[model samples]
Target: MRVLSRVGCHLCEEALPVVDRVCAERGESYDVADIDADPVLVARYSDLVPVVFVDGVEFATWRVDPAALDAALRRPR
Candidate 1:
């Protein structure tokens, strides 16, 4: 999983832990990408920080829904 976020984004701050907890429980590893670090990412996700991607596919945005995250993680990759 990957979290697309930027510095000082409250929603991103909130969503990251949910992703971390879920991934930790499942023994999975995830990475965070700062949208501001890349021009294209900034353009694509500037207003959508906290976006979550599973296997490179967009899964959630804005807030992390624990149930949905768990379910997505459980899916066969």
Candidate 2:
């Protein structure tokens, strides 16, 4: 999974704990890359931090509800 987040973004902060818990509980591996780290990503996701990509595909963005995230994760990868 790819999580596009900023260093101090509130949305990203909110999503982190949830994602961390899910990953730990499900034994899933995920990568959290900062949106501002890559120039291309900084441009693409400047206004949309906290974007989520699952299995190399975008699964969710902006607002991520835990329940929805859980459901998305539960689906066969």
Candidate 3:
């Protein structure tokens, strides 16, 4: 899983813990990318910080849904 975020973004801050907790519970690994750090990411998701991706596919946006994330993590790849 991955979270695309930006500095000073409250939504991103809020989503991180949910993602982290879900991933930890499932023993899944995740990465966080600051959209501002990558030009391409900024272009694709600047307006959608806090975006979550599982296996390189978008899973959630804006707010992180714990139940949904748990389901996604439990899904077979």
Candidate 4:
């Protein structure tokens, strides 16, 4: 999983712990990317800073549901 985020974004900061806790419980790993650090990301995710992706596919945005995230992690890839 990965989180597309930017500095000083409160929503992004809020989403991090949710993602981290869920991934940690599932023994999965995730990374965070600063959208403003890359031009393409900045353009694509300019208004969507707290985006979450699982297996390279978008999973959630703005807010993350821990139950739903756990369900996704339980699925067979």
Tell me the whole-model lDDT of each prediction, alpha carbons only. 0.92, 0.84, 0.91, 0.93
Q: Candidate 2 vs. truth: CA RMSD?
A: 1.2
Tell me the tens digit of each residue's lDDT in model 1 across 1-77: 89999999999989999999999988989999999989999989999888999999999999998888999899998
Screening candidate 2 with a backbone cut-off below 3 angstroms (N, C-alpha, C), the clashing residue pairs are none
- lDDT agreement of model 3 with the native: 0.91
lDDT of 4 by residue, 1-77 (tens): 89999999999989999999999999999999999889999989889879999888999989999999999999899
Model 3 weakest lDDT span, ten residues long? 41-50
In model 3, what are the clashing residue pairs, if there are any? none
Tens digits of lDDT, candidate 3, 18-63:
9989888999999888889889998889888899999999988999
Candidate 4 TM-score, C-alpha based? 0.96
**Tens digit of lDDT per residue, candidate 2, span 1-77?**
77989998998988888888887877887899987879999988899879988888787777777777778888996
Give the distance in Å from residue 18's predicted Cα in candidate 4 to where it truly belongs: 0.2
Residue runs of model 4 more than 4 Å from their true location after superposition: none
Clash count (model 1, backbone only): 0
